[model samples]
Target chain A: MILKSLIFINGFALFIGFLILFLDKVISRYGTVTITLNSEKEFKAEGGKSLLRVLFENKYFIPSACGGKGTCGYCKLVVSEGGGEALPTESLVLTPKEIRQGYRMSCQLKVRSDMAIYIPPEYLEIKEYTGEIVSTELVTSDIREIKIKLVEPESISFKPGQYVQIRFDVDGDFDYRAYSVASHPDTQGEIEINVKLIPEGLGSTYLHALRPGDTVYFSGPYGDFFLNTDSKRKIVCCAGGVGLAPLKAIARYWLTHASNREIEFYFGSRTTKDLYDHSMFEEMAGKSPNFKYFPALSDEDPEWDGERGFIHTIIDRHLEGGYKAEAYLCGPPIMIDAVTDVLLSKGVPQERILYDKF
Target chain B: MNLALILFASIITSNIALTYFLGMCPFVSISKNIRVASGMGIAVTIVMTVTASANWLILNKVLIPMGLQYLQFLVFIITIATLVQIIEIFLDRFSPALYHAFGIFLPLITVNCAILGVSLFAMLRVYTFWQTVAFAFGSGIGWFLAIIAIGGLRKKLMFADPPENFGAAGITAILAGIMALAFIGFTGIASL
Candidate 1:
C-alpha cells in the first residue's frame, strides 16, 4: 500500500514537471517579432531577441570572434531602422566613425519590433561545416596540426588564403575562435587547421584536449586575406609562429596551380625548435623554381648554420631594390608593426600589404 | 514584522548589492549614468520580486516533498534564467517603450547574483509565503536605492577634480566602502 502511494506521488511530480516546462514554452510563444533579413530571407524570431541570435538561428552568418559575448567587437551590421537605443555593450565596441555609418554590434542590438538589416554581401555566402578529426599531430610544443574530414558538405570552395571560425562546446557554453585554413582549396573531404594553444583560450584549450575521431563544429570560408591574382609583382610572405597557417595555405595553392609568380616566404622563429614542416617547404621549393624558403631564427645554436637575425633584417638584406612587390605578413602585433615599418621604408605600398594580427 | 520595517531594513541595513556585493557587474558598469542606472534598478527590482515568489512556490510545493532539496541551486538558477527570458518576451510585446529602456539590462539580469541571492536567502530563512513576497520586494527596492544613490554621486563626481590615482574605480570603491559603513547605522532599527 505504501509503495502504491509513493508511485502515485512520483507520477504526480513528473506531471508537474511537464506542466511547468510546457507553461514556460507557452508563455515564451506569446511575444516575438518577425524579422525580414536582407529583403529575401524571412525568420520568425522572438521579439526583443538580439539580432545576432536571430541571424544565427536563420543560418545567416555574421562574424563574431567573441561568440555573442560582445567582447571581441567583430559582429557588426547595418540596420536600416527598428533597432532600439544604442546599448552600452554596443557603445563600448563601436568607434565614432562606425556610429556615424550605422554600424551596430549585432549581438548587442535587440529587435523590439519588425526589423530590416543589411549584412555584408560576403557573409551571406559563408557556410557552416561538420567535419571529423582525421589526424592530430604536434607542430610545435604548444601548437597542433588538426586535419578534419568534411562530413556533410563533401567539399568546400574557398580562396586559398581565407580563415574559418572553429566552435567548441566548453562548460555548457559555445565558444568560437578563428584559425586560417591551412589545406589547399582543391583538397576534397579534408580540411587542415594549425592551432597554437593560447594560454587560457576556450577554443585552444579544447583543441589541445581533442584527439582524432572527435567531431568538431566549424564554419567558414570567411576572411579576405587571399592572394591578389592581378598582381605580377614579387611576393614577400612573412610569417611567425602559427602565422604559418594562412601562408602555408597560400603556398599550397601556389605550388599546385599558380606557377608564374616569384614568391619568397620568410618564416621567423625564436629558436630552431619552433620550426615545423620544414621538409614540406623544402619540397615545394624544389618543385617550383620561382619559390624560395628562408627560415630565419632569432636565436640559433652554435651548431646551426642558417640565416640568424630578426626576419626584418633578413628581408632588408635580401629584398633589395625597394618594395616593387606585394607583402603579406601574419604574426604578433609587434612583429607586424616592425615589419610594416621596414617594408614601407623599402617602398612597399601600404595598400599592397595584407595581414591579420591577434 | 511589518512592511515599513521590512522596507527600512532592506533598503538601508541589508542592501543586496552594497551589503552583500551581489550584482556588482551591472552596478559598476551601469552606474556611470544616473538615467540608465535608474532604469536598470527598476528592472532588477521587478524581476527579483517575480523570481523570488516563483522560486518559493517551486521549492515548497515540488522539491521538498520529493527529497530533491539538494537540487535547489540548480533549480533556482535554471528557473531564474527561464523567467528572465519569459519576462523579456512579455515586455517586448506589451510595452515597447519600457522594453527599450530596460532591453539591454534585462538579459544580463540572468547572471546578476542579486536575484539568485534573494531567492536563496528567502529559502534559507524559510519565510512564510507573504513574508517571502515582502522580503523579495524589499530587497529589490534596497538594491534599486543603493544603485541610484551611487549613480547620482558618480554623476556629480564627474565634474569634480579627483586625485590622480583616484579616478574611475578607485574613487568608486572608496565611496562604496564609506556608504557600507554608514549603512551600519540602520542596523539598530527593529529587525525584520
Candidate 2:
C-alpha cells in the first residue's frame, strides 16, 4: 500500500507537470514574440511576460516606483500597435487623453505577440550608475544625509531636483527605492540624498543601514521636478521634513548661478530638533546678500520665539502686502494643501505654484 | 446533505469567508474595489470548484487505498497549483479576454485556503462523488456571495468616514468582522 501510494503521488505530480508543459507547447504557445522599441531597438521575448518585466530584463530604464505593481503608474509606455486593447485596470491609472494616445501602464499590460512600444527619449537617457557611499551623516534626529561617488561611467548630469532609483541587495534579488538628488547639479562624480527613517520603510531602512564604502547601484535622472529657469519672479520655497531634498538642489543651483535676489526659503518643522541642517541654510544666507531663510516652528517651543504657527500661517501674516512670487512647496499633504491655499489667496497664480507631495 | 440545504447553508450560515474566514487575504485586500472584488469572487468560485473536485479525486483514488491520507495537504496543494497553471494557459490561448480579466487572480487562487479547506471538508464528510461535487459547487458559490457582499459594503465604505484607528487596511478588517457577525444571524435559520 505504501509503495503504491508513493508512486501514486509522485506519478500524479509528474503527469500534471507534463500536462502543463504539453499544453504550453501546443495551444498556449505564441512562439517567442519580437519586441520593437522606439523604432530603433529590437528584442525577442516570451509571449506571456508583462511588458514592464520584458523592458526591465532588456536593460531599458523605465522608472517604476512601485516595482511593476500597477499602483504607481510610473512605468507608462505608448504601444503603437500589436498590444491589445486597454485593460480595465490600465484605465484606472491612465487618463482619457493618455488612453486615446495609446498610453498604458507597462506593468499591467502583457506582451502577447509582436508589439511596438515607445519609450520616451528622456527615459532612454536614464542609465544605471554604480557608486560608493563616500559620506553619511545624521543631519537631524531622524534624517540621514549621504553622498555617493560614482565608480564606473564616472559622472552623471541630471537637472537639479530630478531623482534616481537606487537599487541594493547585490547577493540576492534587488530592491529599488527612489531618492531625489540633493547635491549641486554641476558636481562631477558625486551625488547626495537625504533620507528620513520612517517607522518601518524597507527603502529607508536599507538606505539608513548603509555605511561608507558600501557599493550602490542606481538609475537616473527621473522626475519632472526641476527648476524652471525662465521664470523671473520671486521664488517662494517651502519645505517640510525630508521634502527639502529637491528644493535644496534647486536652491543650490539658483543661488550659485542665477542673478536674481528674490529667493525666499521657508523651512517648516514642529520643533527645533526636527529641523534638519538648520545652520546650513544660515551659512548659505551669509554667503548671499539677498537670500532669506525662514524656519517656522508649528507646535509650542520654549526655545523658538520666531514664527510660532504653521508655515502657511506665517505666509498669510507676512503676505499682507502685495508681492508677485512663484511658489515651490514640498511637504506632507496637509502642509501642501494649506500652503497652496495661502499662496493662491495671496495672488500666486495656480500654474506658478508648483509642489511635490511627500 | 440535501442539495438545496447545502446550497443555502454554504452561502449564508457556513460561508467560506464569513464563517471560516478562510480567504481573508484576498477578501480584505481585494474587497476595496467592487469591480475587482466581483471579478475576484467569480474567478475564485471557478477555481475552487475545479480544485476541490480534482483534490477529491486525488483523495479517493490516490490517498485512501494507499493509506497515504497523511499527505492530503501536499497533494491538495499540488493539485491546486497544477490546475491553476493549466487553467491560466488554457484561458490564455482560447479566451484571451477572460484570461486578462481573471489571469492575475488565478495565481492568487492557488494560495487561497478556502479552496483547500472546501476540499478537506468534502473528504472529512466521506462524501460520494456527486455529493462532493455538490459540496464544492456550493462552497464556491458561498465564497462568491460572501466576498461580493463584503465588496458591496466596502464600495459604500469608500465614501463613509472611517474611524481614527481605521487606516485603509484596518477599515477592511473591521468590515470583515462586522460581516462575519452579520452572517451569524443565518446560523439559527439553517443547521448545516
Candidate 3:
C-alpha cells in the first residue's frame, strides 16, 4: 500500500506539472510584434513583455525611477499607435495634458501588438558606460564624492550640469539612482559625483559604501539643467550643501569657457564645517576680474569670520536692480524657492531663472 | 440528497463565513469599501466553486478507489494552487481587462482558507459530485453577501467616533460577531 501511494503521488505531481507547462506554453503565445521607435527605428519583439522591458532588451533604456512599478512617473513615452489606453495606475501618474498628447507609462503598458512610440532625441543620445572607481572622498559629514574612470568607452562628453543614472543591486532587485556629475566638463576619462547619505535610503547607502577599484554601471548625460552658454547675461549661481555639485561644474565651465562674462556664486551651509571647495572658488574669484564668490554660514562658528547669514540674504544684498542676470539655482526646495523670489524681486525675469531642486 | 435544500442551507443557515468563520483574513482586511470588497468576493466565489468541485472529483474518483484518502489534504491544496495559476494564465491571454481587474487578487486566492475549507468540508460530509458543487457555490454566494453587508456598514461606521482601543481590526471583529449572531436567526430555514 505504501509503495502504491508513493508512485501515485509522484505520478500525479508529474502529470500536473506537465499540464501546467502545456497551458503556459499555449496561452502566453502571441507570436512576434513590431516596435517602431521615433518613426525611424524598428524591431520585432515577443508579445508577452511590457514596453519598458522590450525597450530595455533592445538597448534603449527609458529611465524608470520606481523600477517599472509605475509609481515614479519617470518612464513615460509617447505611444502614438497600438499601445492601448493608459491604465488606472498610469493615469494616476500622468497629467491630463500628457494623456491627451498620447503619453503612457511604458512599464505599465504591455506590448501585445504592433506599437509606435516617440522617444526624446536626447534619450537616444544617452549611452551606457562601464567604469572603475578611482577614488572616494568624504567631502562633508554626510556627503561622499566618488570619481570613476571610464573603462569601456575611452571617454565621455557631456554638459557640465547633467546627471547620470547608476544601476546597482540592492536586496536582489536592481535599483537605478541619478546623481549629477560634479567634475569639470572638460575632464577626460573620469567623472565625479557627490552623494549625500540619506537615512535608510537605498541609493545613498549603496553609493556611500563604495570603495576605490569597484566597478560600476551607469548611463548618461540626462537633464536640461546645463549652462545656457548662448545667454550673454550675468550668471548668478546659488547652492546649498551638496547641491553645490552641478553648480561647481558650471563654475568650472565658466572659468574656462566664459571668463569674460560676469558671474557671482552664493553658497550656503549650516556651519563652517559643512562648507567645502571654498578655497577653490575664492581663488577663482581672486584670479578672474568678472567672477565673485560669497560663502555664507547660517549657524554660529566662533572660529570663522566669513559672510554670516543665509545665502538668500547675501544674494539679495549684492543683486543689483538694473542688471540682466540669468540665474542657476541648485539646492533644497526651500532654498531654491527663496532665492528665486529674491532674484525675481531684484528685476530678474522669471524665464531667465532655472533651478534643480533636491 | 436534495440539491436545492443543500444550496439553501449552505447559503443562509449554514453560511461558511458567518456560521463557521473559516476565512477571516480577507474578510476583515478587505471589507473596507463596497467596490473592492465586491471584486474580492466575486474572485473568491469563482475560485471556491471551481476548486471545491475539482477536489470532490479527486476525493471520490481517485483517493477512495485507491484507499489513499490520507493524502487528500496535500492533493487538494496542489490542485487548487495549480488551477488558480492556469486560470490566471488563461485570463491574461484572452481577457486582459479581466486579468487587470483581478490583478493581485488572483494570486492571493490561492492561499484563501475559504477555498480550502469548501473542499475539506465537502470531503468530510461525503458529498457526491453535484452536491459538492451546490454546497461550494452556495457557500461562495453566502460569503459574498456577508462581506458586502459589512462593507456597507463600515462605510457608514467611518463617520461615527469610537473608543481609542477599538481600532479598525477590533471594530471589524465586533461587527463580524454581530453579523454572525444575526445569521443565527436563519438556522431553521433549511438543512443538508
Candidate 4:
C-alpha cells in the first residue's frame, strides 16, 4: 500500500511538470518580436524579454553592472519607436533630460513588437570572454593577484591601462565587478588582475574562494586610461595597495617599447609587509635608466630603510622645478584626492592627469 | 450584515492601502503620475474582480469538495499568477491600447499582496459568491481612490519647500498617515 501511494505521488508530479511545460510553450507562441538594433542591424528575438538581454544575445554588448536587474542604471539605450511605455523601474533612474531624449533602461523595456533602438558607438566593440583561472596568489591579506588563461578569442588586443569586468557564480547570484587588467598588452592567451577585497563584497567573496582551474566569465577590454601617445611629457604613475593593477600594465607597456620620455613609479603601502612584487619593479628600473621605482612606506619599523612618509608628501619633496609630467593616479578616494591636489599644485596639467577610483 | 455593508466597509472603512497596506509597492511606484496610476488602478480592479469570483468558485467547487481547504493560500497565489498571465495575453491580443497602458504593470500585479489579501479575507469570513465579488470590486476601487489622491498630493508637493530630511519618503509617509486618519472618519457611517 505504501509503494502504491509513492507511485501515485510520482505520477502526479510528472503530470504537473508536463502541464506547466505545455502551458509555457503555448503562452510563448502568442508573442512575436522583431528588434532592429542601431537601425543598421536587425534580429528576431523572443518576445517579452528585456531589450538588454536580447541585445546581449545578439552580440550587441551594452555594459550592465546589475545583470539586467535595472538597479545599476548603466544599460541605457535610445528606443526610436515601437517599444512600449517606460516602466516604473526605468522612470526611477532616468533623468528628465534623458527621458526627453528617448533614453530608456534597456533591461526594463520589453520588446513586445518590432522596435528600433540606437546603441552607442563605443559599446559596439565590447566582447564577452570565457577564461580559466591560471593562478590566484595573495599579494596582501586583503588583495589577490588572479591570472586567467583566455580560452576563446586566443588573445585580447587592449590598451595598456584598460579594465575588464569579472563575473563569478555564488549562491545563485551572478555578480560582476570591474578590475584593471594587470597583464601586459603583448601577452597572448593569458591575462592578470589584482583584486582588493572590499568587506562583504559579493564578487570579492566569490573570488577569494576561487582556486586555480576554475572557469570564470569575464568581458571586455573597457576604459581608456592608457598613456597618451601624442604627448611626450614625463610620466608619473602613483598607486596605493592593489591600485597597482593598471599602473603595472602601463609599466609593462613602457618597459617593452622604450620611449625617450622619463617615467617615475610611486608605489605606496602601509608597511613593508603590505608590499608585493617589489623585484618586478626593480628589474624594470634596472632595464631602463629613465624609469624609477619609489616604494613609499607610511609607517616604519626599527629596521626600516628606503622612503618613508605619506606618498603624496614624498612626491612633493622629490618632484622638482615645475616639471611638465602627465600624472596617473589610482588608489583609494582619499589617497587619490590628496595625490591629485599635490600633483596639480606642482604644475601638472589637469587635462594630462588620468586616474580611476573605486 | 449584508453585501452592501461589506462593500461599503471594504471600500471606505478598511481600505487595503490606507488600513492594511497590502499593495504599497505599486501604489508608491506607479503613483508618481496621475494618468499611469489611474490606468494601473483600472487594470488591478478588473483583475481583482475576475480573480475573486473565479477563486470563490474554485474554493467552493474543487477544494471544499475534496477536503483541501488547508491548501487555499498556495492555490490562490498560483491561480492569481496564472490568471494574470492569461489575462495579460488576452489583453495584448484583443485590446492593444489598454494592454500598452497596463502591460508593464501587469507583471507587478501578479505578486501584489492586496489581491491575495482580499481572497484570503473572503475565505476567512466565509463570504458568499456575490459578497466576494462586491468586496473585491470595492477594495480595488478603494485602492484606486487612495493612490490617485496621493498621486495628486505628491504632484503639488513637488513645488513645496519640504524639509531636508522630509524630502521624498519621509513626507510621503506623513501624508499617508494623515490620509489614514481621515479615512477613519468613515467608520461611523450609517449601515447599508
Which residue pairs come into collision in candidate 4? Answer: none
Question: Rank order by TM-score, top first?
Answer: 3, 2, 4, 1
- Among these predicted structures, which one has the highest lDDT? 3
Deviation in Å, model 1, residue B33 alpha carbon: 3.1
DockQ, ranked from best to worst:
3, 2, 4, 1
On DockQ, who's better, 1 or 3?
3
Provide the overall lDDT of each model, using Cα atoms, as 2-decimal numbers: 0.81, 0.83, 0.88, 0.81
Model 1 per-residue lDDT tens digits across residues A1-358: 5564466456655765676577656644536677777788767877646788778767777777567888767788877777755666677888878877788889887666788788888898888888989999987888899999999787888887788888777677565788888998888678899989889878888888888999988888877788886777888899988899888988887887777888989999887768888889989899888898998899857756899998889888788545678888888888899889889899998999898776
Candidate 1 global lDDT = 0.81
Which docking class does model 1 fall in? incorrect
- Over the stretch A1-358, how does candidate 3's per-residue lDDT look in tens digits? 8898899899999999999999999888988999898999899999888898888767787866456778767789999998767777887999999999999999999888899999998788878899999999998899898999999886888897888888888787576777889899899599999999999988889888889999999888777788998878899999999999999999999999998899998999998778988889999999997998989999999977988998999998887752589899999889999999999889899988988877
lDDT of 4 at A133: 90
Regarding lDDT, does 3 or 4 come out ahead? 3
Could you tally the backbone clashes for each prediction?
2, 0, 0, 0
Residues A301-353 of candidate 4: C-alpha lDDT, one tens digit per residue = 55559899889998998875445799888888799999999988998878888
Candidates' RMSD to native: 7.1, 7.6, 5.7, 6.3
Among all windows of 10 consecutive residues in model 4 chain B, the one with the lowest summed lDDT is: B88-97
